[model samples]
Each structure stands twice: as C-alpha cells, then as structure tokens.
Target: MLLKLNPEHLLLIRTHAASTYPEECCGIILGYLANESKTVVEVIPTENAWSGETLEDNKRRRYAIAPEIMLKIQKEARDRSLHIIGIYHSHPDNPAIPSESDRIQAWQEYSYIIVSVPNGKAGELKSWHLDGDRQFQEEEIEIA
Candidate 1:
C-alpha cells in the first residue's frame, strides 16, 4: 500500500513536528482510499494526549490522541465524505520508523506516517501500514 499527500500537507506536518520538538507530535489524516493508495485530503494537528506518570512514558517518546478528538474528527470527515485513512506522528531524534510500541498500538488498514525531527528540524518523512500479520510494512509516499 501507499499514501499520497500534497506538498502543502507535508509541510504542515513537518512544521508541526518541528514546533513540537523534544516531544512527539500527533495528528489525524483524512483522505480517500482507492485500491492500494490512500490520497490525503486534510491534515489535522492534534495535541499529544498521552500523559504517562513515568519517564518512559514521556511525550518525547510516546503520543496519544484523545478519544473525543477521534470521534470529532470522524464525524467531521464523514460529513465531508472523507475517511480517516491514517495517523501521523513525529519521532524526535529518532528514526522515521515504527517502534514496537507503535506496532502494538496500530490498527490494521490504517497508514502511519512518522516524521523524524532532529535538532528541532524535521528530517525524513516515511509512511507505514500494518499488515494482517501485525507487522509494519513501509508504504510509498507520493508528494504531488
């Protein structure tokens, strides 16, 4: 599978990641899915809702979006005739790859976009899709 996003949408995600440097930034992706491609129609920047009590649960290494936000986005997207095709987040000072925690938290059929933020700057951007076997497979990202 692959994900298609416009330059503007990409930029928005990158900027949001950079702005939230040292912590994970997360959001929702609204788009249409056809065959093997998910074409992005909108990017919604959201707050990192995960508040872990321990250092291991810090936002710098983890992120979560509120369930209420998810419901709200779903309703808005449905009204606009779009679907929630994926979720996006930043990996501050880490590779743009899905970690074990990511895989455990992911839902099949949803694309996951990870942006690498290094030194408060957005570096590489990559997309992933969890397969039936519960493994993350790299997804092609088409920016057009």
Candidate 2:
C-alpha cells in the first residue's frame, strides 16, 4: 500500500537521519486518518540504547527501541488518533534495503522504513512491508 507523509514528518525523518549519520538512528511512524485511507502524521525519534560503537566490531552498528520509549510512542499515537504504522531506522553503511538481520527482527504487522546513510549522508529512504510468508515487499512513500 502507498503511504502519504506530511511535510513535518518528512522533515523529522530527514533531519533525524542526517543528525545520526554514521550511527544508526531509530523511531516510530505514526498514522492518522484510518477510516478507508491512512496517512502518516508524525515521525517520533526515540532514544537509541545501542547507538554507540560496538566493542566487538566497530564497523557493525546496532540500535534498539526501548520498551519505555515504545510505550510513550504508543501513547502519543493514541492521543493523536493515530496508530503505529511502521518502524524507521538508519543504515549507516548499507543501502536502503532490508538486511538479513533486519528481516529476522521485523514483525509481521509493522512496516519497516530503512534510511541509508552512505558516506555519512542520507542517500535514500525506502519502506517495506512483510508478506504472508514473512518476506519484504517494497512500498511507496509520498511526501506531501
């Protein structure tokens, strides 16, 4: 399905991704207008517990959305008459494609938006939805 993103939400994702370049950034995508059509109203960035360098492998990066933050996001979504439509994260080194680890960790109900920050710049952002067999299918995101 296609998703329409507001200007503010688009800016938030772009700024957040740019600010956290070279390290993974993460957040939640909140959706409103849920009757017959849905549109994204907000993108909330949360604290990344795993945002720093890894002792085992400096090249590899990790990030996780804490339970407390998740609860807060849920509350915010509810307050705004919205729902959790997706989860967003920046890929420091890789392209805007779902990695094996990402696929393994993604839930069936949530869309996954990957922002690729190659060369410490936000190169591209892409969205994916998991199918019945748990495989990713690309979705279009329109900024309006």
Candidate 3:
C-alpha cells in the first residue's frame, strides 16, 4: 500500500508534533482510496486524551483514541464522501517507528503515520500499513 500526501499536510503534522512537545499528539487523515493506495487530502488534529490517565499510561510514551471519536470521525468522513484512510501520531524523543503497543492496538488495513520528535524537534515522518500478517509495512509517501 502507498500513502500519498501533500507537502503542506506533512508540514501540518510536523507543526502539531512540535506544538505538543513532551507529549504525543495525534490526528486523522481524510482522503480518497484507490486501488492499493490512499491519498491524504486533509489532516484533522485531535487532543491526546491518554495524558490525563493514570501513571501507567504515560503521555510521552503512549497514545489512545476514544472509540467514540473514531466512530464520529468515520461518520463525518463518510458524510463528506471521504474515508478515514489513516491516522497520524507523534513520538516524542523516539523514532518514527511503530511501538509494540502501536502494533497491537492498530486496526488492520489502516495507514499508521508516525512522526518522530526528538527533544521537541520534529525529526522523521513515515507511514505504515498493517497487513494481513499483522505486521506493519512501511509505505511510500509520495509528497505531491
């Protein structure tokens, strides 16, 4: 699978990552899906709700999206004739790679865009797709 996005959209993710330093920020990618591909057309930022949870749920290390939020976004996407093709989240001081928790929590067939922000500076941004084998495969990000 391939993830295509505009350069400005990438910038938006980076900005969100920077603005939410020390804690992970997350958002949605609304787009159109073609054969074997998803093109990001909009970035919808969301609040990181896990930060306020118990100590076990470290804001800097983990992220959680309320099921209702996902459902609402799905409805909104469908209403706009678009799809929630993927989700993007930041990893403060970590690599732009999926953590074990991410892999386990990820929904199959959705693109997971991870951004690395080291020392409050945005570093790398990459997208992955969970396959039938229950593994994440890095997808090509065609910035058009």
Clashes per candidate, residues 3 or more apart or on different chains? 0, 0, 0
Q: Summing lDDT over every window of 10 consecutive residues in candidate 2, give the lowest-scoring window.
A: 51-60
For candidate 1, lDDT tens digit of each residue in 18-137?
999999999999999899899999999999999888898899999999999999999999999999999999999999999999999999978999999999999999999988899999
lDDT per residue, candidate 2, 1-144, as tens digits? 677787677668767887887768889988864443347877789766664455643323667788888898899778867899888888886888997777887987677888888777777888898889989998877778
Q: Model 1 residue 15 lDDT? A: 99
Model 3 over residues 71-105: C-alpha lDDT tens digits? 99999889999999888999999899999889998
Rank ordering of all candidates by lDDT, starting from the highest: 1, 3, 2
Q: Pick the candidate with the highest TM-score.
A: 1
lDDT of 3: 0.89
Off by over 4 Å in 2: 33-37, 51-60
Say what the RMSD of model 3 is: 1.5
**Which regions of candidate 3 deviate over 4 angstroms?**
51-56
Instruction: Quantify all predictions' global Cα lDDT against the true fold.
Output: 0.96, 0.78, 0.89
